[model samples]
Target: MRFAHLRVEGQTTPRLAVVEGESAIFLDEVMRRAPRDLQDLIEQGPEGLARVRSAVGAAEPGTSVGAAEPARGAVDPVASDPAAPGTLPRHPVADLRHSSAVLRPAQVIAIGANYAAHASELKLRSETAMTIFSLWPNSLTAHGATTTWPEDLTTQVDYEAELGVIIGRPARGVHARDALDYVWGYTVVNDITARDIQFSEAQWSRCKSFDGFTPTGPVVVTADEIPDPQELWLTTNLDGSIMQDASTSEMVRSVAEIISLLSRSATIPPGTLISTGSPGGAGYSRKPPVFLRDGSTVTVSIGGIGSLTTHCRVI
Candidate 1:
């Protein structure tokens, strides 16, 4: 099943919901007590997920309270009917706004130079051990949200389209063969970066941590839905041109390898989001530089996952 964090237009808080085609089913409406967010649900493990599935199935055909009566106060989607313990609240998908699918993760770890072609084009080393880095939480943004950066701060803001892996269980010293088993879900990620700052700094974290830099989601697909993470195709469309296009199979280090390696040192806790690096064709490497200017719309898509788009504005 696909999941996302959504809030009503005027609502300031985000709630976890299941995405069904064009509609969204607020999980809290279905379960007796739903996990607060994606991170919360992930930490609950498989048993909690099973309950969510059961409740969502039961509420599928019902009209959401938000849909039925716009003026009615917000109801916890998972709240049981006072009269009936099994009843759930249902809402229309159109009535809600999306937030980053995964929120408040323990940390955001990113793999760099993991793809041979990408490393070669960017002149980064791919021969050595995997290049890893961290993305600050401030960079997290949701799909359809406008991400803005100060013009004086960055003139060369570029985009790195990547795959995001969400860990479901605490993992330490996990083997590559077993690493995928610890994964909870997958989502499309746009690892936006400031090229000028990246080259000026010794470490990569700061340059990529600008507010709204890492735009993930649209939705997260369960691990069971994606049998092979390494075989999927990824592409980036800047405006109308296809800038970067490659397959996950081209990675110098597979997703499993990155997880195993990370686990060896740090206990990768549940809800840890790991962006699996981009392929060749960054805007900086193009013959004529292609930076995201004001009004630019960039989209990143993974074959099995979905397309995630971001609108850029330079203030």
Candidate 2:
């Protein structure tokens, strides 16, 4: 099942909802004790997911409370095309505003130099031990939102398309082979960065964690729907140009390995979001060096998870 945090225009608070094709069913309206958010649902474990599945399955046709079965061999489509036709109190997804896919994750961890091509382009080495860093919560923003930074502070703002993995339970000393079982779902992430700060500082978080730097989700696809995370394709479009194009397969370390490695020293708490790094073609690596500027619109997409778009404003 696909889950999202959505709110009608003018509403300050976002409510948890299950998304079907082009429409959404707010959980509070359909169930008495609905999960307050994706974090709550994940914390409830398998039983919570089972309950949600049962509810969606039991709904009658023409109602907003039904689930749309994904077609075999097809990558999940981003937003449902044109609102679905039905009598149910279905609201058009297009009309709703989005909050961050994960509003209250336990923590946010990012991997650097996981993709050899990206490492090479930026003149960093991926052959060394894994590069890990923390992102500030203030950096997290919703899809279709605006991300702005002072041009005087950073004229070289850039975008990195990445796959985000949300941990379902506390993972401590997990084996690489069993790491996939610990994941709750996947979301698309645009790891926006300031090249100037990145190159100048010894550490990375501040350069990449500027307010509204990380834009995640249109929605999060549950783990069961994705059989293998390494096979997915990822791409980035800056304005009208396809600047970053690569596959998860190119990563020097796969998702499972990164999880297992992190779990060895620290317990990866539930609700933690791990951005699995980006591929080559960063604006900094371009011949003329492409960077985000005033009025720029950037979209990052992973095959199964929908595209995450962010409007850029430079002050």
Candidate 3:
């Protein structure tokens, strides 16, 4: 099942909800002891998920959720009607706001130069040891949120479209063949970066970890739904133009390989989010860089997952 952290307007707390097309079923409304967030649900393991599945399945269709229906006059009529096409006892996703897809992830590891084209364009070596970096948790933000940076800091801000993998179980020394079994789900990520800082700093984490730099979600799709991560397509749209269009098939290191390689030395704990590098077509490599500016809107989309959009502002 697909899940997202969403909240109604005027609320500061985000609640985990199961997404069904354009509607969202807040888990607390259906399950008495629902996991508070995606991290909690993932840590609960298979039994936890099974319980959720059973509870959601047991509820009568079109009953406005099992026992914790929305407060009176709060339901959207179009999404609650039993006869309405694809209706459920749910609220329209359009009515809700999003939080980071994987809140409180154990860690956010990023793979760099994992795509041949992206590596070649940046003049970085892809044949050598993997270029891995940690993204600061403060950088994490939700889809549709605004990401701003000071103008004096850097002018070459760019967007990278990438796939995010969330681990389901502890993974250490796992073979490539078995790496995927540990995956919990997938989400879209826009690895926004400040190109100027990236090249000057010896390490990459700081340049890319500006507040709101990593915009993820809309939703996370459980691994069972994605049979092959490499078959997906990733694209980036800046303003109104399509800037990056590529396939996961283009990665120099497949998702399984990256996981296995990382697991060789350290235990990849459950709820860890690994951003599997971005494809080429970065604005920095354009004839004249097309950096994000105040009022610019960028979106990164991964097939089967969802699109994550960020509005940019330069102070």
Candidate 4:
């Protein structure tokens, strides 16, 4: 099942919901003890997801949410569901606001130069050792949200389309053969970067972790739905042009290998999102380098998952 953290247009707090077709079924409405957020549900393990599946399956149309009075100014399906299309009270995804796909994650780790083509274009000579870095939580933003950075801070803002993996359990010393067993789900990630700082600094955290730099999801697809992570396709569309196009198969190391290597030294806790690096065709590699400017819209898509869009702004 696909899941997202969404809010009614006028609401300030986000609510967890299951995405079905074009409508959203708020978990709070159908279940007695709904997991608070994706993180809450992940912590509960397989049983938690099973329970959610059952509740949504058994829910009847037009029934009251299991919660009390819908959190003040929140959608009251029983009383006011503005866009209930079917017999059930469902909200159209277009009318709701989005939050970062992963919230309160244990940590956000990113692999750099994992794709040989990407590494070659950037002149990174680190194929001998894996390049990994942590992304500041402040960078996390939502799909359809606008990311802004000061013009003085970065003039060469480029986009990287990556497949994000969410860890489902505490993984340590895991072998590549069993690494995928720890995945909770998958989501699309736009690893927006300030190329100028990236080349000057020794590390990547600050250059890529500016507030709102990382826009993830529109939704997260569970692991069962995606049988082979390496078989997926990733693409980036800047404005109306397709810029980055490649398959996850092009990675120097697969997702399973990255997880296993990461787990060898540290315990990768539940809800940790690992961005598995981008493919070639980065704007920086072009003859006339392209960069995100004010009023730019970028979308990153991963097959079997979903497309994530982020609007750009420069202050």
Evaluated with lDDT, which candidate comes out highest? 3
Task: Work out the TM-score per prediction.
Answer: 0.92, 0.92, 0.92, 0.92
lDDT of 4 by residue, 1-315 (tens): 999998876677788889877777787765556777999999999989987776566545554333222443233244222223332346677777899988888899999998989999999865688999999999999999999999987899999999999999999999999999999999999999999999999999999999999999989999999999999999899999999999999999999999999999999999999999999989999989999999999999999988999999999
**Candidate 2 C-alpha lDDT tens digits along 1-315:** 889998887777888878887887676655556678999998889988776675555444466422322121221121212122342245678888999988899999999988999999999999989999999999999999999999789889999999999999999999999999999999999999999999999999999999999999999899988899999999999899999899999999999999999999999999899999999999999889999999999999899888999999988
Candidate 2 TM-score over all chains jointly: 0.92
lDDT of 1 by residue, 1-315 (tens): 999998877777888888877777776555557789998889889978887777666654454455543332344343543213334555666677889987999899999988888788789999898888999999999988899999999999999989999999999999999999999999999999999999999999988999999999989999999999999999999999999899999988998999999999989999999999999999988889889999999999999889888999999
Give one digit per residue, the lDDT tens place, for model 3 in 1-315.
899998887777888888878778777665656789999999999988886676555434454433332543223222322222333357778888899998999999999998999999899999999999999999999999999999999899999999999999999999999999999999999999999999999999999999999999999999999999999999999999999999999999999999999999899999999999998999888888788999999999999999999999999
What are the lDDT scores of the predictions, listed in order? 0.87, 0.86, 0.88, 0.88
Give the Cα error of residue 51 in candidate 2, in Å: 1.4
Worst 10 residues of 2 by lDDT: 70-79
Off by over 4 Å in 2: 64-88
For candidate 3, which ten residues in a row score worst on lDDT? Answer: 75-84
Question: Whose lDDT is higher: candidate 2's or candidate 3's?
Answer: 3
Mark the regions of model 4 whose C-alpha exceeds 4 Å error after superposition: 59-88
C-alpha lDDT of residue 313 in model 4 = 91
